[model samples]
Target: MKKFTFKIFAVAITLLLSTSLSLELLAQSAGYEVLFDGGSLEKWRSKSTPSSPIKGWKVEDGMLFMEGEGGGDIITKDKYGDFELVFEFNLTEKANSGIKYFVDTIYNEKSGEMKVNGPEYQIIDDYNYEGVKEDPNGTTSTGAAYLFYPPKNKQLNPHGEWNKGKIVAKGKKVSHWLNGKKLVSYTRGSKDYLKKKTANKFKDDKNYGELKEGHILITDHGDKVFFRNIKIKKL
Candidate 1:
């Protein structure tokens, strides 16, 4: 009788564990996919690589690393029209970089296959990022949207430390987050959105906000910047 009771309890315990695991998996943010896994570039295409193919972007010590100068920006192989992307990034001291989406790549007469006309999530040394002026809004810091919008808080950690970031875009909804706190949100192409874009320097660029779908781009702004845990979900 004791043995039978023990067997029943073991089965119950196993079932409980299985259910708990399932719940945890389900709780994860849906419609998202991993862009990098510290292993291989399964969904990336380099515009700089032609013919023999260019391959220098790689993963090292669990962080994505880029080698040499003029490697060009790494972009998603598949274009995304609407998405919510989340990733972690750490910049070297005095590092400069950015994350841009819905960007159109253009080959100019001088520069070949360069990304143009996209809203950028400005990434830089918060304490040292330049050209910020005191304005009506109190968010003119490093994390601002390069002049259009400003983050509500400056919660980014120190240099060389991992920090969480997120970009959410669906229909007309777009949001930027850092360290689990929402910084700014606005519609992409609504009347108000277009009006604001016109008011800003992006006004002259007709390509601005015209792309309903485009490639996600990680900017290599001529600095040593490290990124990891990059993932995104379709919304």
Candidate 2:
């Protein structure tokens, strides 16, 4: 069946020309709640480079939007173990963005600080990002494990409009979807997820996606990325 989804951060917000759904209300008992309410930032934090937090996100037209460049990583102040996240996103021609969960940002030996390990729900310009130019890296694709798992289809929508995204994280299992298409699914810390990790550049990072609980993060990779209707139902 054809399907589509979006994110409804921890808070609630309404928008013009927006399609409303109860991904949150429907999942109320399931621990579902809004993350972005078009209000001030309370349960959120930002880290532009490494652990250095920056400001670049705001709410507009009922949607949580990342304004003019330079802003860094904006993440939820709270942490979670198991949950379902749904958000709506739209980008510029070559816009780059993504939602990351199960994040355990810690310091590395060699590097002063970094997002040590966490499973990220892939998002990007599929066909228009800078990767399609300069240096081609699978990590920049719309639905790849950011260089681990590569999405087969170019189902990503064109920049300037909205595209639905979903992330399901329960225990050792994780899944990603874009525009209602399955991009990747694997059990966290599982042999399968571990196998792929071992084969990729993340092999050395034992902490990668190993978190049994962590916070949510939104990456402001220097491009325009808008999000809204962010809701999460914790399992």
TM-score of each: 0.76, 0.76
Q: State the lDDT of candidate 1 residue by residue for 1-235, as single tens digits.
A: 9999999999998976565344334435454567876555667777555333446666776678667687667778778888888888887776777888887767775765554667778777765545333345533444556556788866988787888888988876788899989988877777877877778778888887678888888877677778887887887
Model 2 earns a TM-score of 0.76
lDDT of 1: 0.73
Decoy 1 TM-score against native: 0.76
Which has the greatest lDDT?
1
Question: What tens digits encode model 2's per-residue C-alpha lDDT throughout 1-235?
Answer: 1232233421223532232334434546466777874444555777424335446777666667678766677778778888888888887777777787778667566865555356666676766666645535555577666656665554877888788888888778777888888877767776767777888787898877877788888877777777876777777
Evaluate residue 164 in candidate 2 and report its C-alpha lDDT on the 0 to 100 scale.
86
Worst 10 residues of 2 by lDDT: 1-10
- Give the lDDT of residue 84 in candidate 1: 86
